[model samples]
Structures are given as C-alpha cells and as structure tokens.
Target: MPLALRDAFIDLEQYERLCAAAGEGERLEYLDGEVVRMMVGGSTAHHALTRRLDGLIADRLAPGGPCAVFRETMRLEAGTARFYPDVFVACGAGVAPDAETRGVPGATVILEVLSPSTERYDRGRKWLRYQSLPDLRHFALVAQDQCRIEAFHRQAAGWHYELLVGPDAVLRLEAVGVELRLGEVYAVLPALAAGADDRPAQAAFTPAQVASIAAMRGLPVSGEIEALLAELEPDACAAAVAALVAGDGVGGWAAILPERLHARLNARPDDASERG
Candidate 1:
C-alpha cells in the first residue's frame, strides 16, 4: 500500500509551487527533493569577489552577443536540482524571463564562491547534480578565504580537473574563451591571513606563530601558503603540542594542533609571541 504520509522530498511541481509562495525573501535551492536556504554565506569577502568577478567577466565578453553573464539573481535547473550560481555564462538563445525566477537558457560555465558551512555541499552533492546538465562545459569553485580555484572542464572522455594556486594562477575556459586572473580576482581581499573556513569566526593562531610556522614550512615561504596554515588542522600525530597551545592560549585552542607545527613554531628563538 502507498505510504499514508507526504513525501520527504518534493517533486519539481511541488518545488515550483513552493517558489511561488516563497515570494520575496531569502533565496531557496532545491536538490534531490530537499529545499535549502541560501543563508550562512554572503560574507563581505564573498560579496566583494562576486561583484568584482561580474565586472571582469562582463568586461572580457563582447557586448550584446549571444554569450552573456548572469549573477545570483538568475537560476538554473540540473536534473532534480535548481541552483543560483554566484556567476554563470550562458550562450545561444535566452530563456524567456518569468515573474518569480529567470531560468538559465544554457549554462556553459558556472562558478561558485565557497563558504565555511556550504563548502562540502557545493563541492559534493551540488557538483554531482550539475553534471546532468548537457550544456555545462565548465565549473569552478572560488575559495573566499584564500586565493585558489578548483576548476573542472568537460571533455570528450570525461572531466578534467585543474588546481589553480598563487596570485598569478589564471582560470581559462576554452569552451567560452574566458580567462580570469587570480590577482585581479583577489584584489578585493586584504594583504594576508590564514583561511578561517575550517576555524571558528575568530582566528585560532597568533600572528607571530603563523609567521614562524611559515618560515619553517620552507625558507622564504609564500604569503599565500603562510595564510593557509591557519586552516590546516593537523592529524592526531602529536597530542603534546595540542595540550601546550591549549594551556598557553597561544593558538586559542583547548586541544587540536600538529606536533610538527609545535616543533617548528614553538622552538623558535624569538619565542615572544603576539596575539592577533
């Protein structure tokens, strides 16, 4: 017999009605019958990057061509999911505008700005669903807390993965003839700081300790790499280091640090540490 209760996940028809009743408010996304609210992100850095990329992408594209850029205001469907990508490029004919939402005509490229809470979902489930779209030629993940991008481009055989690091790294989508420079993309961000997505809202390590750790990682370390140490939670190879930092209030943790980092940063001759 059919179940007496309603379904856990809604169908596309139900999703449309929900969108209609949603009216004007926070953005909503549907995936595999689940509705998710687009909250817990929208950081200042996220907004700044989104705005800057919009300008850069728009500037590079020829004006008034079939190819065009769309912001978060636009929505696209992939199999059973609907996503409001931070920025996307669609070519060929345009989807007719609607009252509630503007559907994507054909998404050739999609880029999403990663946030702490939503990073997993964006990279995993959402990414899998997007593959169902036949026109999606390229997809990129923008790291808000650092200068990095993970891009995937569709190929005849399968998808090709490319990791772009450092400020000089360039993102090129051959399908649409689009290129994004990392330096220009990260200009909106400040000089340097470790990525805080894996950490609490506040920084976990002191500035001096971070610098010291950066030096030990390698002589004349890259500032980008230095800023990334704050996000790396070491494996449970060293419990003593975690205890010391936890008690000293140096790294702002009661426990949870790498023994290697302790041997390197804690043994510095300039042991005088200053908190950020």
Candidate 2:
C-alpha cells in the first residue's frame, strides 16, 4: 500500500513518538512543525546504490568500532531543524538520546543521494542549513543518475572539496577514519565504460564567478568587488576558476567555505603579488 500524505504537526517530542511507532514501516520527516510523508519508493538504481554504500560502511564498523553507521531513519540536527540523511557515520556512541530519538550533534559525516527533484535543495538551502552544525565533519553528495560524487571536508578554518572522477578513485573519509574506493560505492550498479580521463571536465572559477564566491564568503552583493575578492584569495579563486574551467562549478566548493575566511585570504594574495 502507498503511504498517505497528510500535513501532520508534531514537535520534537511528538515526532519522536510517531517515528518510533512507525518503526521501519513508512517514511516520514518533520517539516514546519508537521510530519510529512516522504516518498517511500525510490528508484531501483537509488535503492541499489544506497544499500551497497550503506552495507559497505556498516560492515566496516561492526564491532568495537570507532563509529556507528546508520541508514535512512536516523535524524540529524541542523540548527532548529532536523534532517534525515540517506546515510551517516557518527563518531560517538550516543547518537540518539534514546532508541526513539534522532541524534543531536551526532553525525560526523552525512550523505545525500541526489536526484532531479532534490539536486537543487541538497546543494543550496539544505546545504546551507547543514553548515550550521559544528559536529558535522563532511558532506557527501551522491549523484544517483551519474557516475559522480562530491565530498566536502570541514577544516579548522573552513571546508574543502574533493571530486571523485570515476569508479576507480579512492575516496578517503579522514573524518571517520575510513577509505572507500569508487568501485565499492557504485557497486551493483550498471557498468560505466567511462574512466577518470573520459569523465567530464573539472569545475573552474572565472572572473565572472567572483560574485558567487564572494556571496559564499558573505561579501557585499557586487560583481567587481567580488571578482577582486576572488583575486585576493588566489588559491580559492584558483579553485573556483578550476571548477569553472572543469565545468562543475555547482559542486560543493563554494558553499563549504566560510565567508569571513575569504577576507583573511585576500591578504595572502595581495602580499604574494606585492613581493613579485
């Protein structure tokens, strides 16, 4: 039977009880003080890949492990809101307050399986919200239809991005002390003839991209100044340029970086060029 769609209101307490009662039966999420039913049936490809990835990580953290691997039902806190990540790895033992409660400042890593309907929100609004969490160490955006994945690692200052080109690139999860090859992640899915070299070009940032980068940096809304700011942080600007050049600008690089750091980075670029 298909799940029913109803605008059901539940606070954090009530949501806990409801989720516990449902068990593994139907899918629900807390949105605007209401429990909204999520699409229980995902695409075959999505489920296949999700299961494979989940199994691989869980198998790794079986007994006396450093972390706990959880699937769809585990809720992670982001500001006042709660998000149900597709897969997550929590470094600590007490992710949930109890068996019935979702985690609070729990997950070290969060994964989002991207689809056409969710690609924008996952990258934009939701991504912004996730940034507010201090415990979150990394965010992995998995492309459901394509042979691509983007991982963002939170550094002391800000965040950095890594792109896994093909099914051969080894992805390292330093935050969770694990490493996964692209093959393991994409296993059981259809074969991809494309290798790293045959994959699409990398993303790069250009002068035009400065505004977006500056906005991410929390700079004022101006293109020229933003471009100048980008020039100021040549490394960051170079990263953006590289992403634009590679054609994957929409990847996580821009969002992962904090706005204030860009201001500090501006000094380095200016100091270097002044010496030359």
Candidate 3:
C-alpha cells in the first residue's frame, strides 16, 4: 500500500515531529507545505550508483576537509520544502545540527538519480527550488539505466548546462575539485546488451525497438529516448513511438506516458534524417 499524507499543511517543526514519530526507514519529504511520501524502494541500479557516487565524493573530500559528503538520509531545508538529495556536499562550516532533523542549511553540490515516479518533480519543481539555495554551486541529474548525466552549474552569466554521455565520458565537479568517469560511475551494474532493452518486459517497446522506429521515422535516437526507455514497458514504449511516427500525434499516448517523454518526442525535428 502507498503511504498517505496527513490531511493538512505542515510547518517545518511539525514535519520534523512527524518524521521522528514515524520512526526510521520511513522516507518522506515536505513539499509546498504538504508532507508527501516518497517512493519507498529504489531499483538496485539506483542504489549502487548512489553509493558509488557518495564514495567518490567522500574520497575526494577526505577527512577533516572543508566539505563532507552525505547520502539520501540527510535532510535539506530549501525554502518551505525539504529534500533528501541522492548525494550532496556541504563545504566550509558543517551543517547546523538539530536533534530532531538532519541536513545542512545549504549544500555546495546536489545530485539526484532519476526514477520513474519522481523524475517530473525532480526535473521541474525540485530543480527550480534547488536553484534558490545560496550555497549551491552545482546540481546533477543521473540516469540509472544508462550512462548519462546532465549537470547544471552556476556561472557569472547564469546557470549553464553540460551533458556527459557514454562510459568514456568524465564528470568533473570543478566546484569541489573532483572528477568521476562514467565507467566508474556505472561500475558493477549488469551490462546492457547492444540493441537490447533495459526496461522491464512489460514496457510497450524496448530500447532497440524505439531506435528502429526512430530510424524508420527519420529521427535520431537520443539520450532522452534512452531515459524514456528506462521508465516504460515494451508495449507502451512501442505504442508511443508508433503514434508519433504515424502522425496520429502523441495526444493518446500522453495520457499513458510520462510528461518528460511526451515533451521530448514532441520537440524532435519533423524533417529529421534517418540514422545510417
């Protein structure tokens, strides 16, 4: 059964009290004055990647350094909402301690491993809220099923985006003076076979099938496709692509697919050339 939120808006102190009474291992978050339940379990790939990234950050920072790395259990207070980033770093002075709550006032860097249920909130609402943190220098969104990461960093002009794809690529966190290779980041995960689908069998189409459809439609298969494929079952995946190819439009599929996937497919060039 899914966890249910209490029927009223909650303040930070009340939120902390609810967390304590709920006991350990019950993951929850406060968003827009509502205490929402986070997805309880994560895929093995998500867990592994998070742990590896945490270790990588910790090793780079070392003990008694200016910064420290913390995992998802740590709470972060940003504006009126609270988030438990997959992994984060706090630099200079340590986090302000609260006996009832755990998390830093502001994080130097924040990372989140995308999941099917939370991808929208992570990319949309959470992203907007995170940018407001005064100490945040970088924010990264990692894909669990593919070797890809999108990092956003603050710059003099404004925030800038950098995309890293493929196992050979490296993610450099210049703010914290550490670099991590995609290969290292994805280490220990089951190898995804060439032209094979990484999503569960229930999906409408596999990654390979999506690529084939894209090729037929004269569209290029992109990282966004891979990310979408990670969330869908074989049949639904195939149906979504087919709808786009047939020019019947994505309206019917939008009801069934994630908003992000719908937006990506909609943005593709209509005159795209077939991949050779």
Candidate 4:
C-alpha cells in the first residue's frame, strides 16, 4: 500500500503568529500554510528600482492624500490564502491592523518584484487571485533582471495592460496619480541585452511560437507585454531593451537577453487604458 502524504496547509491565524514570531529583519509569507522564506539577498538593481518607485510615489502623495504605501510583509488575503507583495498602494489608509484583517477591499495598486524562481507563479496564479478583488485599480510587475514593468488597470469591462521599458519610457501611474521614467527606475542597474519572446527568430513565429504566445497569455503575466510590443517603433524597442538590460539586480544578463529582445520587438501595445 502507498503511504499517504500529509497535506501542508497553514490557516490564517497561525500564519500571522509565525510571521510575528520571526520578528524584525527576517521576511516571510504564508503559502498553503507553509512559511515560505523570501529572497533576502535582494538584488541591488531590485532595491534601486524599488527605491525610485517609493520616492516618486511618496513625492506625488506628499500633497496630502489619503492613500498609503506599504512595503514587504503587510499581509494580504485572497480567499483563504495570504501573501506578501514587494509593495502595495492602499487607498484611504491601507489594510487592516493585523493578519486577521482581510485587507482593503478597495486596494488601489499592488506591486510585485519579479525574481526568476517566483516569476511563473507571480505572473500566473498570483495575478489571477488578485483580479478577484473588487477595488484593485492597478497591478504592476517589475522585472529585476530587466528594465521592464507591466501595469494592469481594472476597467469597466475588464482589465487592461500598460508596458513601460527603458529609462526614457514614461511610466504613468495615473491610478495613483504619479508618473516615472523607466530610466529613473533603472538608474543604477547595469546594461544587458533585451529579452526576446520565446519564438522563432525569422519569418515571424512558427506554430510552436504561436502556442507559446497563447500560453503566455493564459497566465496572469502583465497584458502590457503585448501592448508595448504592438506599439514598438524602432526607437521605442531600442529604448525598452536598453531599460530592461540596464538592471543589475537580474544578474543573468547573457541568459535572458535573447528572450527580452523578442519580447520587446514582436509584442503589440495595448490602447484600452483605464477605460477598458
């Protein structure tokens, strides 16, 4: 007879206490009741980009606004699960006092910093879960290895995407009343080759490329990848690639260049905006 495997699951209450027990300095999040350790040796590129975002948003909000910016470890719940994102912009004060608090039903924006290990989940399952929230205005995914950002805004009909790359690319956080240049976000990272969408190089993409493209769409990855690529003029693609490759946090510059290159070139830009 096969031995039964124990199911791993941590309820919300226990998840909260475990996090509290770990205390300051250590970062942790709950996933299926498991105390998953977060990447602590944050890439310098990641930190630099995040700092720029913080400064820009904080500055924008300085004019006395009700929104609050919360960074890493302020727990958020979706259904019965809980998660900690890199940063979150909460309107009118933010999440409740404790883990027990279900989070702001009207969350304005939630941001996640992409790491290779978490990329799939971050773009896939996590995004789908986030979309369930009624008041989620925008969802931003920042790539640490590449100078890229994909922002999704909830629209009256559905969600839409906004892609911003390169230092020159302007990132307008209209949902939060702020805008940042891609260059500013990647000001401190190193230069790298842009990533390419995983597709055939010439004669457009083959059937396989088409399938892969479809697969990428099914995942919760920023719809902006498509949006940005569609509108990419020669200058825009060059700028986007430059911005993505500039990040030092990614570290795998050589490895991801081809993919980044493809992504920047072939994808289409989205025009739906916040009105979609």
| Every model: Cα RMSD to truth | 14.1, 8.3, 10.6, 12.1
Ranking by lDDT: 3, 1, 2, 4
- The residue ranges of model 3 lying beyond 4 angstroms of the native Cα positions read 1-7, 190-276
Instruction: In model 4, state the lDDT of residue 255.
Output: 23
Per-candidate TM-score against the hidden true structure: 0.65, 0.65, 0.67, 0.62
Worst 10 residues of 1 by lDDT: 237-246
Q: Against the true structure, whose TM-score is highest?
A: 3
Deviation (Å) of 191 in candidate 4 = 4.3
Model 2 agreement with the true structure over 1-276: per-residue lDDT tens digits: 113245565577876677668746466666457565555547887777778778888776647866887777667766566667788887765554444465555678888877656554566546666767777888888876556677887776467777675777876778777787876677666564244335553332244444454354343443334444444443455455334323323333333234654444444433332211
For residues 1-276, write the lDDT of model 4, one tens digit per residue: 111122476677876676668646566655555556566547776676666676667777646677777666465665655666777777765444354443543457888877766665665556666766666788888877666777776666455556666556776767778777766666656452232323322211222222233343332224543443454444444333332323311322222123544444333343322111
Count backbone clashes in candidate 3.
12
Error of 2 at 57 (Å): 0.9
Candidates 3 and 4 compared: the better one by lDDT is 3
lDDT of 2 at 58: 79
Stretches > 4 Å off in candidate 1: 1-7, 192-276
Cα lDDT tens digits, model 1, 29-75, are 88777777775337999888888888889898867666888888788
Model 1 scores what on Cα lDDT? 0.63
Lowest lDDT sum, 10 consecutive residues, model 4, at 248-257
lDDT of 3 at 81: 80
